[model samples]
Target: MNLYLLRHTQPDVAPGICYGQTDLGLAASFDAELQRIRAGLAEVHVDHVHSSPLQRCQRLAAALAAGKVHQDPRLMELDFGEWELQLWETIPRGLVEVWTEDYVQHAPPGGESFFDLQQRAISFFDEVSANNEDLLVVTHAGVIRALLAHALNMQLLDAFRLRVDYGSLSQLELQDGRVTVSAVNRRF
Candidate 1:
């Protein structure tokens, strides 16, 4: 199985706002970025393409998916709920303390926890691994982090350490139930 995890192009969001699953559009200059990503992936011969339902990812997936574009809710970004659209720096100190102390345990009001995301990601991986074919996944930074955590056998909390840049590519290959991380955070 060859998995190509592609992070979406830049989003149209204010610098401090937390915009998970907000359905924001791409940045104005995304065309050039998309062209670069498409060109970088020209030789992959993708057999399947998957994406989160969010427009930011779906738009990019539609353009890159020469084979099939499948939307999976399990691939969506972690919902920030009350924190959505709020500047991180401006969040109340008490909330920040709670978040910092136990992000995996603390579910944002009406949202999801990091551990919840890990479970969803694990389920998605199980489905994908069964197919064992080349796949292109267009998704959010959080999805990429979850995928990396699964591939590298890292703790869910450790997922925060991985940096998934916009328009970057990460590759994971699986053979006979064994996994190998071929590359990560490769810019086009």
Candidate 2:
């Protein structure tokens, strides 16, 4: 089984802003980036295409799947809750510190913890992985990192160290009963 993870292209928002599950649109560079992503994936044989319902990912997924995408809420970005559209600098320093200290188990006010996101993401992954078909998931950085962490049994904190850049591609392959990470943050 081949699992391909692709993060959405740049969003049409300023840097330093917190946006998770906020449903933002793509940036002006989306066209070029999308073209690059399409070119990069031209060689893969995708049997299934799943994507987050957010516009950023939906657009890309639709393009890749030729409008035959399966939208899954579980693939959405982490719910930032009250911090959804707020600038990171504007969020309370104390709250930020607390969440950053142990984001895996700590939930932002009204939001879920990284562990919660992982549970949902893994559930979706497991369900689809049972088919043993090649999959293309257009999702967020958080979900990709969580999947990578789960596959490698790495410390949750260490997953944060893996940078999932916009429009980057990562892959996992399952052979026999073992899963191996074949790529991480690969750009065209």
Candidate 3:
């Protein structure tokens, strides 16, 4: 089975502001970016399209899939809660301390931890693999990181090592329960 992972286009959010599952919209310039993405994937025939429930991903997925978008909550970005719209530097000191010191175990107030995200992503991947079909997933950077970690068998806490830029594409192939990463962070 082939998996094509696509991170959403640039969001209409302020710089340095955290926005996870915040239902943000894409920038107006994203129309061109979406066109580029479509052109890049023009050759690979897509079988199914999935997206996070967030509006940012859903909107793009709908357009790309031509209204064939399927909602997958597991693909949602890690919840930021109180830090959802705060600048990184201005975040409460306790939140920063927890995030910097023990991100793996620390969930933001009313939000999810990296560990939590990893579990959800793994579950989602298992289901997708069982289906064994070509799939295009329009999701967030954190979800992309979790997928990378799952494919590579890296520690969940180390998901941050993967850097997925906006509108980037990653590919993975799964066969007989084995996963091989074909590409990562490719933008066209």
- In lDDT terms, which candidate is top? 2
Model 2: per-residue Cα lDDT over 29-53, one tens digit each: 9999989999999999989899999
Candidate order by lDDT, highest to lowest?
A: 2, 1, 3
lDDT score of residue 129 within candidate 1 = 86
- Residue pairs with colliding backbones in model 1 are none
Q: What digit string (tens of lDDT, one per residue) describes model 3 on residues 1-188?
A: 99999999999998999879899988998889989988998898778999998888988888888547889999999998888888888887876887868777888888889888878988988898898899999999988888898889898777788889999999999988789999999989
Per-prediction CA RMSD (Å) = 1.1, 0.9, 1.2
Between prediction 1 and prediction 3, the one with superior TM-score is 1
Mind giving the per-residue lDDT tens digits that candidate 1 earns over 1-188?
Answer: 89899999999987988878788999997999999999999888778899999999999999987766999999999899888898988878788788878888787777888888878977998898898788899998888898898889898788888989999999999998888899889999
- For model 3, give the 10-residue run with minimal summed lDDT: 95-104
* Local accuracy by lDDT, each model: 0.88, 0.94, 0.88
On TM-score, the leading prediction is 2
Off by over 4 Å in 2: none
Q: What is the Cα-based lDDT of residue 123 in candidate 3?
A: 91
Clashing residue pairs, backbone N/CA/C < 3 A, model 2: none
lDDT of 2 at 152: 90
Off by over 4 Å in 3: none
